[model samples]
Target chain A: MNWLKYIGIFVMLLFLQVFLLDNLHWLGLVHPFIYLWAILMLPIELPRWLQMFIGAAIGMVMDLFTHAPGIHMAGCVMAAYLRPLMVAGYVQDIDRMKGAITITAIGMGNYLRLLAVLVVVHHTIVFMLEAFTFSHFGFTLLQIILSSLFSYALILMFEYLRKNT
Target chain B: MRNLLQLILRYSNFLLLLGLEVVAFVFVLRGNKYQQVAAAGAANVVTGSIQLMSDNIASYFRLRADNAQLLEENARLNAEILELLNGQTRKRDVNDTLSTRNREPLSSQEAPYIRADLDYSFIPARVIAFSEDRHHNYITLNKGSRDGVTPDMGVIGKDGIVGVVQSVSTHFSVVAPVIHEGIFISAMIRKNDYMATLHWHAPNTRRAALEDVARHVDVQLGDTIVTSGMSAIFPADVPVGIVSDVSLGEGDSYYDIDVALATDFNSLRTVHILNYTHRAELDSIQ
Candidate 1:
């Protein structure tokens, strides 16, 4: 594994997330968080434990920036824990699942499915835990659905941009 | 022990999920603003009924003190009556003054709705539970929406103003009292009509700071503070407290005056909830 490449992506994504995207809330309801790209870009060759460890580290950094401490950590860890299961579900041949999650590495259909599931799951947990109640179920659910779709679109764009990587 | 180790080894992934979620929820409960208030409100609702039972029994033992308070208020009202009879009190209106002056003493025949022309009315309520130890203290009233008690109405006791209704259920309502750090009471000194803010910053239950009183005003000892009636919630000129101490810091623009609160929260038994009739209209104007 190239440590330098991973570190570069981590720093760039975290900087964009904390300084830029955090302040840009569309329509005052949806917030597009692109920091999960760091997790999404992880290679399938990494062990499940290490993936989660990296995910938790990313989440902790996000939590430090957000001041709401455990919210991002919970979402990030769950996403990391579910990534491998999603990958296994998509890629039937075990030999093919050992590279970076790119459009070429995983076919277009499986890659979109993986992105949709992880982004929705991560956004759902984060928003639900932030509210900690179903009292305003309508507003919270709308926030989650819109945010998931928006973040999913942005993550797909990022994946397309780094296609040859 | 070997069986336990085998079980742990088999389900380590699930244990990790549980551990991570547990840590996350701990921080959420401890630090999240919404969760903390919701938890506090739910806890108050559960304990409110139990305390109501004990408060009923405990009030019987404190009747002597309560009676003394009522007697003091009665004497003060009687003195006001004598002043009004002597034509020496401040009058809000000439018609009101003339009617009050020519008013005959109540006899066996009196109107049932004497105060029908008044813009506001009071709902009698009992203080079921109150806590002064916490920074953001809350008082629970036995009256709720069922008895026409709603959120944002002012609560007052025999001696002074108490708090505003915060949340109301069917039969119970919680009050964010004057001692709570969140509420800022608008007050004016009776002598000079100097507007200042009453804030409960100091931990002392008996004292609160009268903030923003300009240094130019002569805020003497024993000066009376009352509501300014700038807000739609509270009425004008309701008694607040007395300025117990005043000290001006050198090269300061404001005097740091401390007020000795009139209503002792400890012996508080019953309170009246003020229902301002035109609150919605006043709020809409703003």
Candidate 2:
């Protein structure tokens, strides 16, 4: 594991996200950079413990920047915790996929499986966190669905970019 | 001992996930409480800077409209000046002015609309942003704590009540509009002579409803409703809204009357954050 390389990517992604994308309010209140995709896109060979730790760290940095305390952190850790289960579900022959889990290597079906789980978990945690008081469950659900769709679309766009590059 | 060790090792990640999630949950539960003012203070700085830049751009567009309005106002003032001069000149020429003045009574039916008293020497402000959403409805203004706009200051436009100043920073303030579920203004129907609470149902931005008023009142459609002035927030008889419809149901205790608000929240360019001299004194006593 290249510790320096992972740390560099995390800082750069967070800096761009909080400083640049955070200010970009598209259509009043919608900007889904989903740069946390960098963490989710980490190699499957990395230890599960290390992955969860890194996920928590990355989420903390995002929360610090955005003033949203723990929602992002919780989302990232959940995806990290569930990554193996999701990957195992689709990879019938993990050896055939070159032992590397790039979107192209895993195919669109598996890629979407990972993406859907991560996005749903992230958005659910975020929206539920926002509606922490529980006075407006219906409104909170609406926020979750809307924000999740947008965030998921952005994550997919990033995946497409990574595949093309 | 070996089985217990294996179990602990196997479920360590789940425990870690729960631990991190608990930390995050704690933050969410304590959301916007301890660090709210601090977060808001920081956000205010960023919002202030952005608002300053946007205000410059918006100010450029507003200049032309402002000039036109000023010109129109000047024209009206000039006409009034001419009429006053003509009346003065006519009075000077007429030796029979006493008889003409005596013919008209001191108290006539042409009384002007009684505007509630407000302090004239307070800071002026303009509405920069208005929320159309139901969940978090509010309006941002161009003045703040530096402008003597503290939280809970009464706001009004030319026609009627606008809202109360909710939060204030160095150069900006957020107003909780009458349409927000947060506000409860003590109000009374003018025609029906019944007191009730006015609140926003949130789906409609322009309309709010009267609550707790009994069904026995002789409420007519289009009757004007004004503030009861029971609270020190707003002055007495300040025009609030006009009754659009009153729901007369079989089981409801109060009339579910929809009222079209007097001040248009969408198009509100400028407003007055009323700072009364007697507000603090009155509030403390009450």
Q: Score the docking of each candidate (DockQ).
A: 0.12, 0.29
Instruction: List per-prediction Cα lDDT, in the order shown.
Output: 0.74, 0.68
Shift in Å, residue A91, candidate 2? 7.2
Candidate maximizing DockQ: 2
RMSD of each: 19.9, 7.9
Candidate 1 chain B lDDT trough over 10 residues, lowest sum: B106-115
User: Which sections of candidate 1 miss by over 4 Å?
Assistant: A1-165, B1-45, B67-118
The digit string of per-residue lDDT tens for model 1 on B157-256 reads 7778898887776677888788876688999998888899999852467889999998889899999998888886776777889999999989999999
Span of 10 residues, lowest total lDDT, candidate 2 chain B: B104-113
- What lDDT tens digits, residue by residue, belong to model 2 across residues B45-141? 5555555565566668678886875586567656655875787578768854544433222111111122323332244688765554433356778
In model 2, residue pairs whose N, Cα or C atoms come closer than 3 Å (at least 3 residues apart or on different chains), thus clashing, are none
Error of 2 at B131 (Å): 3.2
TM-score of each: 0.51, 0.65
How far does residue A10 in candidate 2 sit from its true spot (Å)?
10
